[model samples]
Target: MTTGRDILRVTLRRNAGAISAGTLLLGLYQAAETAFPIALGLIAEHTLRERELGSLALSIGALAVIITTVSLSWRFGMRILQQASVTEAHRWRVRVAACGLQPVAGDTDLKSGEILTIATEDADQGADIIEVVPLLISSMVAVLVAAVALGLADVRLGLLVIVGTVAILSILSVLSRRIGTSTREQQARVARAGAKVADLITGLRPLHGFGGNHAGFLSYRRVSTEARTQAVTVATANGVYAGIAQGLNAVLATVVTLSAGWLAFEGRITIGELVMAVGLAQFIMEPLKLFSEMPKYVMTARASADRMALVLSAPPVMAEGRGRPSPGDDLEVEGIVFGGLRELKFRVPAGEFVAVAAYQPGAAADLAAVLAVRVPPEAYAGVVRVGGRELSDLPVAAVRERLLVNPYDGEIFAGTLRSNLDPGGTGRPVAEAVEASMLTDVVALHPEGLDHGVRDRGANLSGGQRQRLSLARALAADADVLVLHDPTTAVDAVTEQLIARNVALLRRHRTTLVLTSSPALLDAADRVLVLDGGAITAEGTHRDLLATDETYRLAVSR
Candidate 1:
């Protein structure tokens, strides 16, 4: 429930010390820079009044000290600011990444690409706010100090400097608001384009096979073009802002210099005061320009912070339970109705192998998600219990430890075969699971065996190989209740048969549920349940259903 402003406050508080130190140093640097011109004026006056080498050396020495201070202060100030900015970004990235990993209680509005962008680019932009505050403070300190020094030399000149600075900042602030609006639009458009590109890349192979590659490419092209247009608009606004800032600064500096020259001609002020006034005017521009640009950075940071807050504030789809589940193998669903399932009732006794062949493809996936605890209990009507314990009452960790639901399309990360298979590195032997999932051929093909490299999402492997590898990974978990959806769909009939036999043998005396229409898997089950129209229409052996049920036969034929 935290707001974007709260996020900004928290970040600033966390990095306050570093930010303060940097700001102090920057202010000192600006002070030293302002002193340089004053020193030059002093040198000029002293040269005219004393005409002594000793006096000239003292002034030159003072100027050298000022120059050194400016150099050192600027270096340390920048170091601190940059380090703080990066560290702040790292904190946000870690937080956003952790939030993304949590289970959502409902549908998520964010896409994978958008989440990635938030974690990286948006996080960095949010952190940049830490520098903005300090820079603005230091720039103001420089401008105010210059104005005071100018006033000390000549009252009118000092008033002019102060008035001009305020006017310039006010004009830029309005322009900066426009830039802020455009920048936010640009960021959103870029994120949309990024999401489209990511979708295209993830489904590239399938798109090619379906001859839909051109359509996807055209879609991405349209989104990318929009992003480009937005980017150009942002750039144009920024360019105008920068040009105005520089032009205004130049105009103000010229006015001050001309006024000082006229005052010296009128013999109203000494030559040294005139020199100092002109130098102060020129020096003021740097800080004035920085002051004018601060508003834009602040606005951009606010937009980025808002995006980050959206991700961090999302509610978890499933709440964690504190109660433990009983150690029993029985899984029962009584009158469950959710998504594509309606009034579905079923039970698989301890150590029983049951298959639920859903007529609709989406129904099977929805059923798997429900069993996997991916959906919250409140979303469904009835109850799912493990070992006679209501699933909602049992701790999520406890249920997950005992039951595993492997989806049809599982992700394969970039790593060696062994690492992907045994990601937890629990030291469980993979040989058994490998053999059970019929991945022996895949392992044998690579000379390195399980150590063979896998590309991202297993892109280097074939469809069958990827499916088998995923199956092997699931089997390797060694959970008590394993539910698999279409585990062998991508494999050949002969391989599927072998896999079914091996899976039955490996999981003998263990509770298992296979949600599939694969004949080999259905035949291997001790009992098969025909689920049609969101209900279990029939329950019998695979052969009995095929022989007596025409609807079941038609479904399995596909």
Candidate 2:
């Protein structure tokens, strides 16, 4: 199981090689940087000791030039590393997004909002490692360079600096493990809170109707507060680790200075050499500090990568068939058996209007899903034939291209009426679809008509209006076979009757399937299939079923 983190690491390694090279150059630059301060101390001491003014002045000038050159190289090298990190992070984000779209046919059990958060927040967090970790490694190399230079000035001071750095890093390594644990906990809490909030927002209308809106709000508030507290805990742990690393660096710097001064006083080392040794020891602390912080950041990224991997690995609901079916208008479900529609068989001629009126509401919805190939036959044994061939053997893309399923709960995005009606903009005009759906009344009421902007999920529209808009969208698609589930469920009896007549008239020469319990719709159907206990128990005209079938009459009478 090579995880998403593995993918991220491989991606970073491939792209951040340039950063590593630049960081190596920076390490060398730091060594040169350390040399300048030593050269200055020597020039000053020499100027005081034997009255060699010219030699000391030249040494000072040479040291100044070296300092300037090293600083420039260091700046450019860091810039290259920074650019490389950013590029690698962006690449990883796109790659992950592409991969996530795979296995799209299954009930991934992931919410849209959660996926959004993962793509934007978790993806970026995982990429942050590329930016910070490389620099931290380069800083460690800088510390090593300082240690080697210190040895040349005083072996004891060099040993002390190395030992102190090792101790601090070891402590940080232990602290990083704790931070990793806390970070994982915090991420989980945040995800849970996000999921709760998304559900509440989506179902806000239902909650209000039930007079439970306050309770739902309180529940979400509790989850949010818990998530916040966990985040603060993770932050506190990180802060403590950083504070310890910084404090250790400061302490080591002071200790090195005092030791170097004592050694100079005892004549064990020259004043200029002691000053240089102290400066190099203090330089050692900076890189050591960066090295200590890298582990925690890398750990946090790993945790987020693990979470994303779970979604990336989910099983898809349906799969693309191996063979492709020829494009045509004919559609059939042979021996199709599922949740409520079982052992059911039906067909829509190449160009004809066929309405499906089921006694069971669940059977109707389930049958529509099966016919649309939204649900897999593998879960519930069935065979759907499109264009006179088994749908299982037909490529899903080809099937979806000609077969459109207009779900009863279809969503409307926040956009102008024209955009919402033709989201795909598949060359279908808005005016024609609205007319076909009998939405002229709706447009007449709106001053903006086609240009009217809808709120999120068409919150501004009534239930019946939203249902009609969804129907308009399906009409706009102009697919060869259209499977509609309760298209007039939200409308009044008179409106339902009108829509039933209008729909049958508009789609007179097209292959159409409607799942309905309404008598008006059944009466308009060429044939009605009675589904009971997930099976097609009877088949006849609407009037015949009303005369003989008790279940059929009771189901549709309401």
Candidate 3:
């Protein structure tokens, strides 16, 4: 759904059956409860005024029946309502998770940690509307029943109860707006704090290397403090709202009770009627209290639903396409203008090994993001083609099957070493890939070899090992058009040379593009293109460029 109202609206529609059943049952319970005091007033009147034994016994029996109805209806009604609510919450959690994993990146301002909170706490709160609606209805049923009973005794008593309830609820609704604001702010601030904590943990290794751990912690502390302050504000607002609602409800009860006694004193009402009016007035306060509190619950639920809406309503990253790339794998780009690139163009013919050295920072990153489909098509100006067909015109699945882009910092999930390398469980022999990426050493050292356990993000592995593992995973995919972005940056000179030569051999007869300035990888490429000044300035073999171009030599030497 696109908005908080939509989420609530749809949830209600989806669980209408449960809500209806629960409301019916709870209404029966409330009717039974309202009758209890009225029944008592009747029993007291008959036993005192008439002194008829049969009448007293019959009144007592009716009271027993009312109590039993109250117990059974309440037990079954709440069970159904709560179960449906839990199930709805689970569905929302899954929906949020799926949105995050979708290929099209949505246009949303929420961070990963914020989404996490939405999927958990916000989802649960949003589903609370399921319970809130029914209970609110049930509370109204009780109030209406009490009003009717009190009116039978005295007209003023019933009118007083009705008007008092409306006034109390109206005042609460206005006051709850402040509570809503505070709740929204509190949730947002808490989500921000969570996001910062997640970032710090993800980059803890680098923070220690650069001695920025203290700085990171300090930044997180600021966010956490803000969250705490917002929480306190929400608590204070709720406190004030509840206190005022309770006071108003008590005042209404007192006024009704006094009015009933005054009527009896004037000899305008019978003794039985007086007892019933006083009992009904006191009992009405319970429903009134519950009804007044609903505004606060609804406000909190709406705020959560709105927080969830931010992610659900974002625009997709890519548009749908019906076309597909043609036969053969050829990498081509023409007149692309994006992020530090101006009219830049290049082509890697099918079955050719090509390397590009972009002298400017973020140039390779931009190219990789575009080629890998990490960027939305509308985000930049470019024509990137594969197999003589435009990437934008082709379907997302077709493009993915035709091309693969291996980034510098690939994610390494927690699993067995083999599972990390071949996440899809293709069962394709990854021995060649392992050897080519120089990851065989890590496997052999653990004795478990490919079955060795891998910590999340390869935390147990050294930097170079993680890099090789990433390369090995990419090589195992064996896509037709593979783009490697600085594939061997972390290894030593000798290991880098081996990986470079092995990648060239392993990827023979397939289109390969290496975006790197590393001399070892450049030397292994059949051809090298030098990117400078937003365009290709020179093209030749690595040695040919090194011997002839001073700028190329200086860049590669570093």
Worst 10 residues of 1 by lDDT: 101-110
The TM-score that candidate 1 achieves is: 0.93
Model 2, stretches more than 4 Å misplaced? 17-108, 368-377, 414-416, 424-426, 438-466, 493-498
How many clashing residue pairs appear in each of the predictions shown? 3, 5, 0
Better-scoring candidate (TM-score), 1 or 3: 1
- Please provide TM-scores, in order, for all candidate models, with all chains considered together: 0.93, 0.86, 0.88
In model 3, the Cα lDDT at residue 350 comes to 99
Native RMSD of candidate 2 (Å): 3.5
Question: What lDDT would each prediction earn against the true structure?
Answer: 0.89, 0.76, 0.89
For residues 1-558, write the lDDT of model 3, one tens digit per residue. 399999999999999999999999989998998998889888887788889989988998898899999999999999999999999999999998877655555557777788989999999999999989888999999998888888888878878888988899889999999899899999999999998887776677779999999999999999999999999989899899989998999999999999999999999887887888888888888888889988899999999999988878776567767897889688899998888778889899999999999998588888888888867888788789999998888877788888988899887778988998899898755999999999989888987999999886777887788889989988888989999999888789999999999999999998999999889999999999988877888999999999999988998995
User: Model 2 over residues 200-221: C-alpha lDDT tens digits?
Assistant: 7656777888899999999989
Write model 1 residue lDDT over 107-145, tens digit each, in one string: 557777888898999999999988899889999998888
As for lDDT, the candidate ahead, 1 or 2, is 1
Q: Report residue 475 deviation for candidate 3 (angstroms).
A: 3.6
lDDT of 1 at 316: 68
